[model samples]
Target: MAIKSFQGARKQQSDTSEDAPFKVSDIMCKDLITFKPEQSVEEVIETLINKKISGGPVVNDNNELIGIISEGDCLKQISESRYYNMPMENDNVEKRMVKDVETIDGNMNVFDAANKFLESKRRRFPIVVNGKLVGQISQKDILKAAISLKGHTWDK
Candidate 1:
């Protein structure tokens, strides 16, 4: 009886999912859909919805991420227009894109990335290397890492 209880206690102390190791690049979305700063807000919204993405990075001719545009930002403009009965004309991405964008390094561990996700309201973070956009990581991506790491059982 004591041995059975000891075995059960040992099983309860087994390593949890958080004990596993993974990297940001492990689960980051590589096929990124990006937009240009000069793009009109209308076009931005169209691309975002069509792509089924919540947001994307705004890159320039040099492949540098200048800002990030999201559905939330576009909706704010749209909501305001409806409230004031104004026209949604001449709205550019540069005008609404967030200039102070937060980026993450591709090599960073998933643990730190998860913490960052919990710390901010932003759903996604642009992955950068040498100051150039490479990919994008989202909260879902981190969750993917957690599931993939923990759900796989190693037949030891």
Candidate 2:
């Protein structure tokens, strides 16, 4: 008599669906905390603390992407204020924000976005479309995406 097997044949691992979303837009946070160039640095600091965010993109009144401001930038202002004995109230987002901003396209692959983070050493990347700030993707977002995609074979 042949030995009986308790387990049945297992199904082969399937590839992720062709339509599966793997782009930055799919994983990025659309409801973003943004700033304005003329906004007071003190206001930015307060919002950053209240929202528990490190930084955000600065936009124009027309909602166009202008620059990025971070906690580090705020700190720089604070430091300068202390060093020069100047009033923090005079500082604004435009003076503190990094104007030469690097943004990511919404359609880029999440994996590619991860590489960009590594290359740029950025904590977050603003997503822009048609010169407007649309959303942001963070290192935390990439980590969340990776964990959510676990157990699946990556296409690349």
Off by over 4 Å in 2: 1-15, 18-20
Candidate 1, superposed: residue stretches over 4 Å from native: 1-21, 83-85, 151-156
* lDDT, residue 131, candidate 1: 79
Local distance difference test, each candidate: 0.83, 0.91
The candidate that achieves the highest TM-score relative to the unseen native structure: 2
Residue 138 lDDT (model 1): 94
Give TM per candidate: 0.80, 0.88
As a TM-score, model 1 comes out at 0.80
Residue-wise lDDT of candidate 1 within 1-156, one digit each (tens)?
354444433343445445554678767998889988888888988898898989999999988899999999899879887889977776788888999998987888887888888888679999888878889999988887777676544321
